[model samples]
Target: MNETQSYLTEVHCLECGHSMPYRPDLDFCEACNAAWLDARYDYSRAADLWRPGLPGRHVSLWRYRALLPPVPEEFRISMGEGNTPLIRATKLQASLGHPAIFIKDERQMPTNSFKDRQGSLAISVLKQRGVTECVLASTGNAAVAYAAYAACADIKLWVFLTSLVPPEKMREVALYGAEVVKVTGTYDEAKKIAANFARRRNLHLDRGAKAIAGKESMKTLAFEIAEQLARAQGNHTPWQAPDWYIQAVSGGIGPLGVLKGFTELYEMGLTDRIPKIGVIQTSGCAPMVRAMALDREQAEPVIPQSRIVVLSTGDPGLAYTLLYRAQKENGGAMLSVTDEEAFAAMRWLARTQGISVEPATAVAFAGLRKLVAGGTIRNEETVVVNCSGHTFPVEKHIMDDQMVLDMKLSQQAKSKEQGLTEALRRLEEQITSVLVIDDNPLDRLLVKRVLQSNKPYRVFEAGSGPEGLEVAETRAPDLIILDLNMPDMDGFTVLDRLKANPDTAAIPVVVVSAKELTPNEKSRLTGKIASIWQKGAFSANTLLQHLVKTIQTGTPSTAGSDVINALQTLDRSIHKIVIVDDTPADIRRLRRFLEARRKYQIFEANSGQEGLAVIKAQRPDLIILDLSMPDMDGLEVLDTIKLEPDLRRIPIIILSGEELSAEQWQRLDDETTDILPKEEITPETLASHVDRKLS
Candidate 1:
């Protein structure tokens, strides 16, 4: 197949043989008007093309750019959104008496959900077609992601959701500059209203409503998992893909997408096996599960719906399609878990893996447990349970003390950031004192309990960031654990105070917060933060491990000698490198180059504010600033750099492949010393310029 137009050449209807025009704005089938639209590519032509170059593309869903629809390169927006970690579900396996359990961590995506991929692609298509506004009706995650990406693209977004939707989810969506409409009825009804509104306003509609395009967006997950498993098992045996694939089902786009990805790989002769997929649902409103059991083509909700609201999808048809497809193709089945079961599973995941998941995600874990207990799933088959959401309930749930201990033991093997030696040092250093700032009494108590596990550490608590800072000033502790959302001056302010003050700055502080952070959030928590461990990400043992690693270690391995040797081969003058674009391709290329050239450290910023922070902190000898950014313009950044006395001395290079006008050129010349157009500057060329500048 030709790599350029492989999986997406035309839009075809699943209901009818007729094809539709390839317009980004036109989502459904033109002929039958079927809502589910499949992308049809010239497969035979694509097959003629040789295997794609691995390690050649960005670490995103765009890595499969050849198979994606016709979105221009310039308009594609991404934020380290794809290639989520596929981890061993050791705790889940033990609970289910299954030896080979795994998890696909979609919760780690940019917007704390798997919807980042579709949202990015949707925004890209909209941008390509020059559409200025878009509206989406989502239960939760998808709405938040679309809002975030639209905000990034500087486009207007309207999110139609139900009043029953969680306030936290609403806050996240609204924070991203989206206009939210809280409908009075079910999500499906809200979606219907949104559709009508879109038509009435002539707003650009994302074809995901019927599920085909949204389903296709998830194909990358299946491809990646298959590839990862293949690499793990090697060529010596018959291909054994995952024995079962389990995930929470709402619109059911993700699971269906996974199935499609696997089908594509199998067709491409990459693998001959496919996993038996498991669809999990909350017992409160399990329309798809009931439909699947009855072998029904459509879905209808179970009555007396339980209030574990996150997985509240009453529309069974959307869910039924995924269940039906998975069962037919992979010999899969559906598992419905009760509200209590899901809540318990969430606690179990938290205690065991130090991962906080909401009820929607926990349903998968609960279902997997049920499968194991019933002996429906075998102990030997490799199973992957998808952790779809990171949002745990604000209120703490009750679990026996023994349960926590057992769970922790089950999850002891996972490696988060590596560095066993560093972990040992930190633990041994003896945290003689501890300080915590959180309003929740339970949270404070839990943190204290975790901190007190090591007798050498003494725990102290603060109600707010300001109080925490005051405590730090008076009684400097060995470490401070801070929370982001506080009543009086947030954690950022407290962090600033600590970093600014010589007394408290050196003490390494871990940020413990409930909020999901973006790349900008990660970047902004720079100076004094040793690590940002979300409230759910850290446990007593994990904290202990970190302390042992940090304080007791002799010297940490920055990189191995072999890595240093590879870096030394590069020009020494290139001590620093900067990535200018928000595009995934550029970020991937620059990151890969810097990774190989280990001596040259890498930094990035989505907007001008982030870029400036990197510049001030790293003080790189070279800089590459993006011409276009949402918050601050590239020209403005250039102006700022020229104005700063110290920053002006650093040599600047234009890394963008974009062309500058004669007038723009004149303006740039007046501002900077060098303009290394991306095309003109190879890695070697970049190295040469660095050599010239330093000499």
Candidate 2:
């Protein structure tokens, strides 16, 4: 039997279920334009290929090559990418009160990330296909891994990356001899350029999530986990899957592949049931988390702004589709953690479990902590957190002097008080109270779960307006997210009651409703509500931003001075300004004017779509929009911005060539700060409007 005979039985489209022959160019489904493909095999026969006591001395992922998409023996690439340590986190478990906790430390892999697993297979597949060159866009780890593996295969690799990527990462990728191109924009922008470059040069492209070989390679993590768990439990009986599988995700290919591995194991009668997967992401770039909260099938792309570079994928390609299905099929949820929380988790893991991880990996631990604190994960269940990467060249970016000092202060306090109890107290101190008033149980749960990801909020639910008011008065919540369609006292009544009460009046209220608001209702709630969100259109990320802002601005008088100080420290003092225009001369002039101010950080976007991405990433205080633009016009952009609860607060100054009609004036007046005709505007006039709005 040759390697070709042992190859995957077939490949099928994940979307349209269309079957096709394996080829590098056949990545997406022809029938449905879907980007994800599933490499299938005769599971019964594949299972027979593996036997007990196998993988004896094999330290690499090739131990499971029988199940993976086959490459010829001579073409295979291996660098000990698998068999990562699965350490029992006993001390961390004691702190969190979980019965059993394990860390699948993938940092031990070559290239110091799980991406090495993907690269090993991806580059091998490329080698098998006789491809000599390839192009890809990466945040950091993938570029390094692919470049390193490609170098070994003697393949020419062109790597495109965002300028914001850490200098150390860029140096490392370039060191691998790959031609690295740094784009002066966001990760999504870099990806677009890379895709175009690949097309123009006719180079093989490694589409992370869309690549079957890369996706299949991730299965090794799951396989190793299952096998190790069995060994740990004496290997007497069939392996039992962990109760929860947690990992920090960007493209979500890792989780998808892990889930597929569990499914295969179940089919082979090796595992009883698949674990509930927890997808963790940084709050700054969390489309997958937002989509899951909204119960959407696809994630809407947003500009990536996460400081954790490896997890800063603005568009996760086809991973969103696979993730949506995985969440629906399994009892799991997506969650997000702030950079602060992730840094704190990194410190905590190092102190408590002796595990050092990058911010991207630390995010999973942060999510796990939140889940345990929120009672989403039971104390008795066994859990595994995939520590996917470590901080090396970017160690300085993980924690600064202030963060280290804070950690030391915390440690000193822990020594004085009950260790675990003191830590839990500190964790609880960070939580803000949120009250959700909705008649529907599902709605309440949905919002509650969404807010759970933010990790700094304790959610209190009320089924009716009266109950809501009672909870708000009793709890004196930092924020109230109200739904307007409740029977016997709608959100309007509840808002009125809450505003009338002195105790709860100061608390910010965000009204969420499925029904359209009348003009009178809008006017009535204008000053009373902090923001109005339509139920179906509400986004978790947007809601979280509002919540964070509310917490920062509306610190309770009862809160301790220490708590107040901590909240204040979380605020970013710098103001961000974004300019969206196709005209380079106009953009240049505005940038020069803005830069002269000395206090503003300016971001430029050449198109409305790019502008939207910038807004999503930076959450700029102000925006300058050109009326006429290609792809998405200024009006369309304005409409889109107005619809977002977070972006709507930003002041927009419209630049138009033609004079506006009364309708246009009214529309602009309703949504924008001011509109300036191109002929009438000067730097001084623009600065005046900007100053007033910013002030």
Candidate 3:
């Protein structure tokens, strides 16, 4: 069979069996519109009509052209999205008593999700059909994935999401440059509005299962898993399918496609038995699970609130279709899991297997646990759980909680000897002196001693704001320690005076008192006070915790083979780091390194073309550059770097290794490349320059 005849001959309604010609712009079954249509194929005229022979084809889902709808190859956008790894669960097997347990890690895909698999295909088809602008209604991963691929394809995308969507996912969608609309109601409501807008605008509606291409894209997971199983058995054993294929069914396209893939393999005589597909749903939104249990023909819509951000679907059309087809084709059933159960399952997977899964993915394992405990699933059955998202959210919350606890625990761990040692260390390190302005001498002394021991601090006594500023001007201390209560001028007055004074404006301040500051007070203090510590509420340990966090946040790590490291180090001291280089590779390497660190805030400019403009906007602390760069040379950057009065104090570290003559060395000494290097770089050398300049 020629490639032209592959993919589809027609689209047939599942309910009425009425066939219609394939159209890229078609959203649903033209006749029924009620039932989702399945793509029909002329099986007799297929090319290389064998399943096992497919290993030679492309690794993506598009490899199955015999099953997907026709779309131009040029329009297909991919980031190597398919062929995910199938991981074995040895620990889960031992505990759950399942002889063989595995997980399909979909997080490995582009955008860290399997959603890309469907998004790439859907957007590709949309582009092919001449749809320039489109709208999507999703609360979580789908929104993120769709927005990104749409951007990649240069298609205008409008995404509608409810306020219930997670803030992080919302930021992701926005970051992808998609126009986002936040609705006050549930995702279903937003979806309804999106549908109406699509109809009014004559825009294309792209659901995971709306097009054959999207659905067929998911088949890559099944084919990959099948090949993996065959390889695992040493090619001697006949390839056997999974006993239980467990996956979370929200829109249900993923699970349904798996069954379709199995049917395809069976038609090719690759397998004789179909896997028992278990449809898992969250208890808060178990429309399909409820329908299946009652043996209803269809599901009624219900707003779900357990996790409105992720599982925000009110309708379960796809889930109902899965239940109807998978249950009938293979002996299977639906299971529902509560939010609590889902969380527990997710945590278990993370702790035991080190696989951090999204709550939706966790629902599948939760269902499997229910089935196992209830003796519904046999111990011998092989189970596969599809882990949908990365475990970053759960881990972030866990880290935040631990940080809070560390502050509390450090108080218990504090000792007088440790305090004295810290005080001596601070004194030797020449950390800036701070004045404690309070009427109570005892409270002042206690805070003084705490800071002196735990941080680089010097204690100064002040009866009021006037006295504090008087000492601050005379001593020009690097920081101020203040109390809200004072005899003459309160700590707030001292803070205001210190900040108003140009000489001491940059000095950091710490508020020390027994009073609990309100949110308004904290906001008012702003840059003047680094933090507020309650007299008894914050111990030396808590101060240390704050210091460590501040330090980690303040300083960029000098690690990596990137040009941005030097600039990033400077950025921590201030707002930005500037690198003036000519080579794209040097700029790219540095930017990538700095971006990866997260600790270092770095920005770059390749030439002198807009070097000064970028510097003005970024306001960098230090500039590291090659002496020669296109449009702007090192001398030009150096001259411009020091020309601005606001940028005069900022240092320049020339990162060049070209062999220099005596004249060149003399020129470097007089100009910005004062710390010029002629050999390879090292962290210690860079650190020395940063410390010498910033300290």
Task: Highest lDDT: give the candidate number.
Answer: 2
How large is the C-alpha RMSD of every model relative to the true structure?
Answer: 22.3, 24.7, 21.6
Per-residue lDDT tens digits for candidate 3, residues 458-532, read 456766678678767655555566788776777777788888889777766666676655666655675455556
In angstroms, the error of model 2 at 410 is 46
Residue range 560-663, candidate 2, lDDT tens digits: 11121111122355466788899978877777777567456566677989888877876778888998998898888999998999889899889998878788
Residue-pair clashes per prediction, in order, are 23, 0, 3
What stretches of model 1 exceed 4 Å from their correct place? Answer: 1-7, 44-53, 207-212, 234-240, 301-304, 391-695
In lDDT terms, how accurate is model 3? 0.66
- Looking at candidate 3, the ten consecutive residues that score lowest on lDDT are 400-409
Q: What is the lDDT of residue 477 in candidate 3?
A: 57
- Candidate 3 TM-score over all chains jointly: 0.55
Better of 2 and 3 by TM-score: 2
TM-score per prediction, in order, is: 0.54, 0.56, 0.55
